[model samples]
Target: MDIRPTDRPDRRTFAIISHPDAGKTTLTEKLLLFGGAIRAAGEVKARGAARRARSDWMKIEQQRGISVTSSVMTFERDGLTFNLLDTPGHEDFSEDTYRTLTAVDSAVMVIDAARGIEAQTRKLFEVCRMRSVPIITFVNKVDREGREPFALLDEIADQLALDVSPMNWPIGMGGQFEGLYDLEHDRLMRPAADNARGFEGDVEQLGGMDDAKLATLISSQGLALLREEAELAQAGYAPFDDTAYRHGDLTPVYFGSALKDFGVAELIDALARFAPSPRPQPADPAPISPDDANVTGFIFKVQANMNPMHRDRVAFMRLCSGKFRRGMKLNQMGTGKAIAVHSPILFFAREREVADEAFPGDIIGIPNHGTLRVGDTLTDGPPVTITGLPNFAPEILRRVALKDPTKTKQLRKALDDLAEEGIIQVFYPSIGGQWIVGVVGQLQLEVLISRLEVEYKVDAVLEPSPWDTARWISAATPEELKAFTDLHRGALAEDRDGAPVFMARDTWELGYVSDRNRAIRFSATKERN
Candidate 1:
C-alpha cells in the first residue's frame, strides 16, 4: 500500500462521554459539523418533536431517546486527524464504553452545566481513570435552564475527583447566557447576535464584569478577571504561570450550547489545538521484531444490519503496527481465511469514508470482510498477538422455547448465527430443556425475537424468564425436590396447560425450596407420559 503523511496529522483519539441527556450526542454532532463530516447539523428530535440521536441507528433506539450502542467517527482539522468515539451514556451499556475506551487516547467528558456530575458520569469517569486516559471536560448546555457553571465545575472536581481547571467560564448561565471568558485569550466570546451565521461578532469586550463585581472578585472571589482587550493583546495563550490550563497539559474547560451552534467553532479549534494525535507514539506494537514485519490491526467491533442487501459493517480497528494497502492479503489471527482488504479508509460513521491508507494509531474501517471478529488481529503475513481486550461476560440471561417444536432444529441454527453476529449466547439445555439465551440487554432480546420470527420464518415461543439459580441458591431438601417433581409431573400429565402451569409452579417451588436450603433437579427431571 502507498502512504503519505498529510502534513503532520495530529495523532489524537478522543471519545465523547457523559451521562444520558447531558448533551454528549449534541456535542458530537457539533464536532462532526465543524469537522465537515455533515453539511448541516440535525436535531436529536427533528421528527415531529420526537428526539432522534444522530449516532443511534436501531429502530428501538430511535423509538426510545437513549443511545444503546457506541458510534465512532473521524475528522480532520488544522492538519490533525481525530478518531472520535461517541459512546452511550446509559449505565446498561457501560461495558460498551469500557471496551471502546481501550482504543482511544483521551476523553472529552461532556457534562451538563445545569445537572453537573451524575451517577453514570461518575461511573464512566472512574472507568477512564482506571485506564489512565486524560480528559478535557466540556460543561455543555450553558443556554439551558438552571445552569450554574462554577458550581458544576466544582462538583466535577469534587465528585469525580478530576483535576479540572476551567479554561473558559460562562458569562451568565441559562436565559441570560451569552458566551465564555476564554481564560487563555482573555476575550469574552459569546452567542451570535441572532442574524450571525457562523462565528461573527457574537464575542464582545466584557470590560471584565462590573466594577463592584471586580472588587468582589479581588477581595472575596478567587482570581481577578483580566482587564479585557489589553490583556488579550499582551498574551497570545494563557500565561506561563497559567500552565495549569494549557492545552494538552491540563484539562481545558469550554462552555457553549451545541444545539444553538454557540461556541462550536471555538470548541473545534480547541479540539484541534489541544487534543494530541497518534503520531510519534509506537502505533504498531504487535510484532516482536521491527524488520520484515507486516502491518497488523486489531478489530474492536463489528456492525451488522438486518436487511441482506445493506449488510455492511465497519470494524473499528487500530493499526497495531504495520503498513497495509488496498487489496492486501490480510489473514485473521486464529483463522486461516485470507481476506483481501477492499478499500482501506478512515470511517466517519458509515456515511463518510476518507480515501487514505491507515497507519499505526489510525482508526479505520474494513468493508465487506465477514471473516474478522472482535478481538481478532489481522496481519499481512505471520500472526502476531497483541494484548487481548478486557473480558466482560454477558450478565443478562433469557430463554426462548420454540412454539413449533418441528422447527426447533432450524431455529437453533438461525439463533446460533444470530448469537455470533450479536455477540450473544444461544443454547439448548439438554435433550428437551428448551433454549436458553443470553444477551447484553432487553433491546437485544427483542431483536433476537424479531429476527427469529421475521428473518428466519420461525414462530417461536418466548417463555417468561426463569429466575437465576446463582442469585437464589440454597441446599435442596428431599421434601422440596419431591414437591418440585410432583408439580412438574402434574404439568406433564396435563399436557400443554400442564407444562406452563407446572413450569411456573416448579420455578416458584424451586425458589421457595432453595431459599429454605434445598436444591431440586429440574434439568434431569423425568417427563411423565
Candidate 2:
C-alpha cells in the first residue's frame, strides 16, 4: 500500500466511536492487530478493569481508563492504508469527539451487544450525521454471556434511525459461539479456538437456520459475493450520499467478538475490499493563492512539556495547504504580524517525537513558536481568517480563587495558558475581583486545580462562578441612540425582560484568537465641519 501524500492515495480514514465500556478500545486493538498496525495489542489496565481502546499516551487517561482525547493511527492491509482515529466515548470529552468527526471521512460505530445503543453512542452518531460522515456498524462483545447480536442491531437501527442490514451473522453466541456465517459468502470459517480473535465464530453450519438469508447467500454465490462486498467495501461510508446504499457502496453491518478475535480474517477481507481510499467529493478550488510565497497551516492543539533542556510548548498543526519549511516568514491568521517558522515538524508517537515534512491531512508538532494559538492560520498568502471550528459552548461554569498572594502571578499565568489551550475560558466580572473560569465539566476543573498546586506551586480554592447582570443606561434623545449604535458596530439586539438588550463582541469568540499580540483596533471618528 502506498502511504504517500497523493491526491488519490489508496487510504481509508475512519474513526471508531462508542459509549465507554462498549468494547470500542478492544475492537480497535483487534482491528489494528489484524491490519498490522501494531505487532501486539496492549490493554488499558485501569483500577480493576482492563480497557483496550486507550492507545499509547498514558497521562490522565490511564487512571480514568477512558479516552480523553482522540488518537490517530495508520495501518496497512491488502494494498490499502487505513487511517483510523480512536475517539473518546465519554460525554465529558464530547467536544473532542465532535471536532474529530469533522476530520475523518468515515466512522465505525461500535455497539456493545449486551448494552445495545447507548446515550453516548446516540450522541456521537448524531455528530457524524451532522457532518455527513457515513458510518459502518460493528456489533462487538458477542463472546460475552447475554450479548444478543440480532436484538442489538435492531436496537441500534431504531435508536440511531438507520436502514440496517446484516453482512455477516454470528452462528452461535457465548460459549456456543464457534464463529460466524458470512451471509454474502454462504460459507463459514471456524475461528482459531486457542488464539481467540474478534467476531470469529466456528462456521459449524452455514446453510443451517435462517433459510431465506441462506438462499440469498447461495444465489449471490462465491464470486458474486466477493464482488458485491468488494464494491461496498471500496466505497466506505458517505454520510451525505443516498445513492451509496442503493448501489451497495457502503458497508452494511459486520458482527464479531473483539476479545476472542472471532472472524478477524473475514473482517480483514471486508476492510480490504470496502474501506475507501482518498474518498472524493465536490472540489472547492484551493484557497492558497498562486502568488502566496509562504507556507500556511492552522494550529489544532498544544502540549506543555517539562523537559530538561527547555520545558517546551509543543503545538499540533495541520498543514491545510501550501509548502512550509524551516525559517519561512509568515503571518498569524488573526493578528497579521510577521512570525518566523522554526524547526523540523514532529509527529507524536505516544509521547515520543518523529520528525517529518507535513502535508495536508498530516498532524505534526512544532516547538518554540510562541503566541501561536488554536485556530490561528499561518500563511504567506493574502491575510485570511479561518473560524467556525467545532468549539462547544461552556455548559459547566466554575471559578477558582488564589489561596496564596505570592502565587497570584503563577496562578494567573496558568489560567492564561489553559485558556490558550482551549481547555477553559477565564472570566472576570465586576462584582468581585475574583477569578472565574468555565469548562466542559468538573473533571477538567479538577485537573486545572491539581496542575496549579503541583505543577505551578499555586494553591487555589475553586467555587462555582456566579452569574451577574449589569444595568444598561440609554438616553431618550435620538442623538444618544445613534451614538450607541455607532459605538457597537457588530452589536446584536434581543428582547430581555420586555426590553431590548444589546450585546457586543462575545468573550467566547475572543478565545478562538487568543494568540493575537494586540487586539484589532478600529475607530469611527468624523471631523465636525
Candidate 3:
C-alpha cells in the first residue's frame, strides 16, 4: 500500500438554492458556462433553460419548467475544482433539497431582484442555518425592474439575521440601468451595445468607488444615486469578513442578472475566492474532516434511471476526506458489505463521464443496483457514520390507483425504485390491499405520476388516501412494539424499510392516538442509521 499525505487540492462543494422562478437553474447554467463546462446557455423557458443541454433533464421537469430533482455538476476554475449541486428550488421537493444540503459545505442563495426573499428561500435558508452552512447571496435579475438594492439588503439582514456585505452595487436599475460598480475589485461592467454575444458585456478598470470614469458610464441622475447607494452600503454593512462569513454569520452579496450574464463571472469568482472548502462534516460518533487520511463518504442521494438507455441507478456520494481511486472496495456501513466501485461518475448535469479518481469536496456517483441508499456511509478505513439527514413526515398521502391492474408487478417495481431514490415514500398497510404513497408536498404527487409513466412505464393514478398523515411508531422493546402494532393493526402500516408507521385521518386523530399510547413513540421524522 502506498502512503498518501493529508494535504490535497482545494475544492469547493456547494449547492445553489432559491425559491422557484428565482433563476436558480439559470444561474446554475450560467455558472457552468463560466466554468467551461457547457458551450451555450440554451433556450429560456420561464426562468430556466429548456434546451436539452440544460440541467433540468427529467421529462416532467422540462414539461413543468421547474427543477424537481437536484442535479450535480463538477467544473474547474483556475486551479480549484468546484462541485456544484444545483438543488430543486420548489418547496415541494424541499425534502430532496434538504438532503442535498447535507452534502454541501456551502450554499449560494439566489434572490430574485424583483421579489427579494421568498417562502421556499427562507425554508432552505433555515436549514442552512441549522447546519451552519456558509452562504453567498446572489441578487439575480438586476438588469430588470426590481426593488431598491438597499431595501433588499435590509430585508435580508432583518429577516435572515445575517450580516450582509455588498461586494458590488448596481449603478442603476430598470430602464436607466447602466452597469455594476464592483466595490470589492474596483471594476465597472456595462451592457455592450454593439459586438456583443449572449449576455456578454464590456468591463472597465476603476480606482475604487470615487473613480472619475463613473461619470462617463452613468448619467448625472444615475451617478448621484450610485454614489449615495454605494457609500451607504459600504458604511452601513460590515465589510466582507472572511472569518464571519466562514462561520456562517456574514454573507457577501453580489448583484447580477443571471439571464443577462451581468455579475455571473464575479459571482463565480466570489465562490472560488471566499467559499469555504470542504469542512468538517457532522457524523454520529464524530465530525469528519477533509484532511482525514481515510477515505470517507456518505450517500446523500440515489437517482434511478438517469440515462434511459442504461437504466442504471446512481448514488451521489460526497467525498468527505482522502482521495478515492477507481475500483476501491469500501465497506458499506449499513449492510456491513464491502462493495467494489468500478465506474465512478463525475457529473455535468445530465452529461456524465467516468471519474478515474476524486478528492475531498468532490461529489462522485457510484453506479449500483439495490446496494447503496441515502444516508448510508462508506469508508475504506475505520467505521464511522455521517449523520444529519432525516426523512420528514409527509403532508400528503395517496393510494396507488393502477389503471391497468394486470401490471401490478410493474407498479410494485416502479414504486420501490422511486422510493429508493427518495422521490416518494411508500407505505404498506398491514390490513389494506392498497399501497399508500407519501410525499412531503403536492408537486411530488405530480412528479410521482410523471416518473411512473415516463421512466417506469407504469400507468398509475394517485387518488387521495383515507389517511392525511403518517407517523413512524417505535417502542422500547420489540414485544411492546408488536403489542402496539397488534392493537392498531388496521391503522398501522410499514414503510419500505418495514418500519411500523401509524396512519391517521387528521392531526386530532394523531393526537388522540398519541395521548393513549404514551409508551409508544410516534415519530414525525425518521433518521436512517
TM-score for each of the candidates: 0.72, 0.70, 0.96
Write one digit per residue (lDDT tens) for candidate 3, span 230-272: 9988899999999999889999999988888988999888898
Assess the local accuracy of residue 377 in candidate 1 as a C-alpha lDDT between 0 and 100: 69
**lDDT for each residue of candidate 1 in 89-133, tens digit (9 for 90 to 100):** 887677667767767767888888778888988888888776566
lDDT of 2 by residue, 1-529 (tens): 5333333244466788899998877777878777765555664323465444336353566767777666766556777666677887887777667756655667788877778888888899888776567777788776666555546655766677676657776645666554566666766655563644443334545453344454443333433444454345334323323456323234367777777776555666655555543333211234433123345556656555423245566666655445555666778765778776566454323433344344444455667535676656666776665433544445565667777877778877788766665666565543355665666766777667765665567888887544321112244665765565465433323211122223323445333322231232211111100
Worst 10-residue lDDT window, candidate 3: 43-52
Best by TM-score: 3
Whichever of 2 and 3 has more lDDT, that candidate is 3
What is the C-alpha local distance difference test score of each model? 0.59, 0.57, 0.88
**Candidate 1: worst-modelled 10 consecutive residues by lDDT:** 492-501
Cα TM-score of candidate 1: 0.72
Q: How accurate is candidate 2 locally (lDDT)?
A: 0.57
> In what order do the candidates fall by TM-score, top score first?
3, 1, 2
